[model samples]
Target: MDSKAEQQLASIANISNQKERTTSYLALLSTLFSSQPPSKDALITLGRHFVTSMSMAMVVGRRVLGSYVIALCAGTSMDTTGTASITLDDEGSGENQQFMQAGINAFKSSEGEEVRRDVVEGVLAGGNLSGWCEEQTTVLRHLYAHLLQLEEDWLGAAKALMQIPLEGGSRLISDEEKLAVYIKIVRLLLECGEWGQAQTYFSRASLLIHVTKDKETNLSYKLSQARLFDFSARFNEAAQKYHEVSFDSAIAEEDRLQMLKAAVTTSILAPAGPQRSRILATLNRDDRVHSSLPPSLSTMLRKMLLEYIVRQEEVKEFEAGLEDHQRATVEGGGTVLERAVREHNVGACGKVYDNISFEALGNILNLDAENAENTARRMIEQCRLRAWIDQPLHLLYFESRSSHDTDAEAQGTAGGLGIENKEKEVEPRLWSERWDDRIRETSIKVEALAEQIQQKGLIPPIPA
Candidate 1:
């Protein structure tokens, strides 16, 4: 026999028991790797000879053997691309493909957390290698991300997925695959409060969302968008997206309910405006609000929709159910929920009174008089409130404005409803102007008659 065959036979013979041959063969491979590094061809030969043994290594539940198998498959000394010097050839040979696939299968089938972690750490220690088969690398990275998730290392999981080269790699990826990875990265980043990063991937996912027919992928994309909106403090958009996702039949009943609850919370947190009023009205009218939603959320929604002033106790109740980000302090002042409530309370005051003293508004909103005035001033300047402040009198005058009135100025007379609504809204203002003119003209005529009467001696005049 040739020297190589003789050496293999001697290695097998050294395994005193046949039952432990898989373990012994793995140990022999480990010994070779521990010594001088073998050539790529030599490693391939050794893998071909003992691939079956590596496949069965996990069945025996030996940690050291499993570690050796991972190193043999993934490599201990990896290059910048994570490709080991002894990596499978790029020739696309069936044997090379089979060898890598078997290594992946063995790594996956193994239940040892330490071994799984070792495999992930080994690959991550070097950068992700594009030269490896895309399919194999993709599966391994996803597996590592799953392990990270189990440990609650959300940022780590997201970073692991970021290693995937969806657009430029050894293989071309489908839209479905890209969407799946982008959505997962968004979700994991959101979990760790990485809003900026989450938004970046969310944009990528949105492009592929229409391309995929996958119900789950579509649902996840929508959910991620809602979350990104929430974290970014785009509450109205978040509320709308959450409401749309909540009603999806594909989602589990429990998860659907949670989404509904999120919708309600975000709706309440949205700025007090016509858009929010429309959403509040929709939510309040939904049968689910009173039935499936908690009483506090339903109650808050009802108050907001009806323009009732939210009390401190009710605000506290709502706050108790808020997520950390929901309660996060925002620019200009208090928590996001607090700012929403303050704005809503000011609007509620507007609904109940044509004008109110800043002091009284401050008392109602639990803010100082100056702060209350500033809040109303900001809302008015933003056009969110159709009211003005009388700085001298320290009062806020609420204007009874409608969407039709603002829509004209914003959209112009561009035909359709704009023309019809403009005419209706304009007529009332025109009548007010005409009434003032008539009063001024009538007063001038009466004054002239009085002067003539006095001059003609028809009436007595007082001496100066």
Candidate 2:
């Protein structure tokens, strides 16, 4: 830093006003990096100072420290993915690298993975932990977990986070902070597509968030669950959850925008049905989408959605702009949009055409007669489409009623649910049905436990 800059920092640090100190620090960071970027050595020095200073206060008084560490972690993006990022983001790579190195220098040189661990171990060996309060210990546990991430032991870190102890029945964190921790773990699991573990942590997060009654955390946690559902191939469920989350006032504009986009994307991939139609319809009339999204992106989403719900026609111009991955249908055997269109067209025919020729079906699904016939067979077999393809007559017979009642009854659905119907089903069981079953099961178990208490004369029972 320039001499003048150092003098400014000195003068600002001397100020006793909390707000002024904060403003000064913000200004300092901007000034320091706004000019030519600082060297690693300069960042290391600054980082060591910050780490030492913060540590002194935390250890001397044993503050909760989560806020300080969390702020530091956020600046470095360590909390974003539950791992220390090896490379810096492109847009602000230089400035971010400086910030990240500062975080690193607090415990270790930029090159040493064992930096935080060593500092923490030293603190523990010195009996520093013995004096720390639960919240303070919580901070150390979080720090140690993050340090494990720098070593690429992210799964281990997640396990450690889950195991952060309680002295009695109380937890070390506030309700909101506890929810945040669970969200962090869930996101980290999502990074590596660990759907099972992500689901587990998200389930816990959903429970923790209920006690606070904060709409923002509630909506954000729903977004996390939606992402997990998306990965689990529960597209329609994810789409519905994303749609709900998008409309919540508590979500930030950026996240809400992304949530809306995801809603449109997943809605297309959801099995063709009235549920899909409802999602698309909701998105179509929402003026917020048009006003909030970029013109090109809004147009693309609209075009893709229209292609599924109403027009399953040729989309060459639209397809031209997509990248190879977008064009490729790796998830369900066709490009995502393509699968949506094909599936929609297949389901739409039951409503419009009771008996259509293979050639006509092909035109609607954007396939050749032979290919369309094959697709119809696959869908019928999978119980996604309620129809039969007659090769001899080169025709498809769309049933007027339940196909299962016919000579060639449709088998159970793709996931062993009931047959596809005229209005169409979303998934194996309606989400509501699943919840009802869970609640009913819980009620029965509770009743059984109550009976056991009364029958066995187990400890004093509650009033009737």
Candidate 3:
């Protein structure tokens, strides 16, 4: 092809008409590949030209043409029967080495294996006797040897095989082979966390489902895709795919349930408000919704609930909200005196009387007060110890008397003993201080008990 023909071909490809553009490109390729006794130099030059043109086409939004060119270069066979094979003649000549080099060069230039194979096959099958000359055969065989070398250098042929663009060419592997490759590449990409690249392969695999009528395979691919999307925080997309697969009758109930769970889990992590509500609502409506899930899943759900609803911070808010209600109740409002009076009225007066005469005296008074005061203290101590060892008592005490000297002078003058005035004067302040101290200590005990119960996940018994 001359510069003038190349220019004309470029102009034809640039035509506004889509059909004409495609036709012109197709014609150009056919003419170029169809040349009888294809010159080795011409074929190599053509391969290079096509690669450049196709790359440019890709850049310029001519994906179809770019893909086609790729297909033409790769040795892709269209027979879906899976019988297509490539054979190289090893004549042990320089021409074979050149052919092989050209083939390898084509492979290196394009990412699409289908195109490279197609071009090689086309060149070989065209029966160009001159192109098949001994030297060219040896060169072609050498190229195959290089490809084999690449296969060995890499862990497997997988890396080399993956480099081939399989989508663009008309002649390609069967759906099954393609699916296998798709799965392999997808797994690799997923392992590498290349979700976006994995998605492209997934999408391509999904297309195979339509072509091959393999509902199960398709669902599996979609499920994998959903998982990837979910991993990437694309919840909506993930949920949609999951829902689609889950609803399909071809899927098993167990599989559907798994998918629904995934969808629900993702939905929960979605932004709060209407979207979440909608997802939950749909989840509730699922026909497979069971009264209980598996133990492991149920355990996970319970943990999530605890974290979301029963964490210490949430517990604090709950407790704060309950404080007002608690305060309005008798348990919260009644003072120790009030409670004691109520207990006495309820025929529990013995406990209160014993506690007051025994415990209070022993703890509050000193032995130097007097023999009588000491005796009172000893009696109080005995009563308190007995009560504590036996059972809990709700009785409480509060001092009603004022300790002011002026008040005492006005109210007392009782009892014949002169010591009575002093005794009376000292008792009120002692009782008052003792009462306050007891109340503070009791409050501390109650709060500590409550905290213990809270930590143990048990409800504390209400006070009687």
Model 2, runs deviating above 4 Å: 1-137, 145-160, 166-179, 294-332, 348-355, 359-371, 377-388, 398-464
The estimated TM-scores of all candidates read 0.68, 0.51, 0.30
**What is the C-alpha lDDT profile of model 3 across 261-329, one tens digit per residue?**
666555434322223333444444454544534443333223222222223343233233221212222
Superposed Cα deviation of residue 37, candidate 1 (Å): 24
Model 1 deviation from the true structure expressed as Cα RMSD, one decimal place: 10.5
On lDDT, the candidate that comes out on top is 1
Off by over 4 Å in 1: 1-111, 128-134, 401-464
Q: Write the per-residue lDDT of candidate 1 for residues 1-464, one digit (tens) a residue.
A: 13573477357746656456654554555444442233233333343333223233333323323333354345212222221122322322233433344344443433434454654456444542434334445555666777788789999989988987777676667677677788889999999999999999998888878888777777878888899999999988999899999899988999989998999999999988767866776676578989998898898998887778999999998899999989889777799988999999998897689999999999998889999999998887666776767678898978775654443232223332333222222112344664586599999999999999988998876779
Better of 1 and 2 by TM-score: 1
Q: Which residue pairs in candidate 2 have backbone atoms (N, alpha carbon, C) closer than 3 angstroms, thus clashing?
A: 329-334, 329-335
For this target, which candidate reaches the highest TM-score against the unseen true structure?
A: 1
Candidate 2: RMSD to truth: 21.3
Q: How well is each residue in 326-409 modelled by candidate 2, as lDDT tens digits?
A: 344554356766776677677667766788998988887767888888777777766666565556789887756644433112
Lowest summed lDDT across 10 adjacent residues in model 1 is found at 76-85
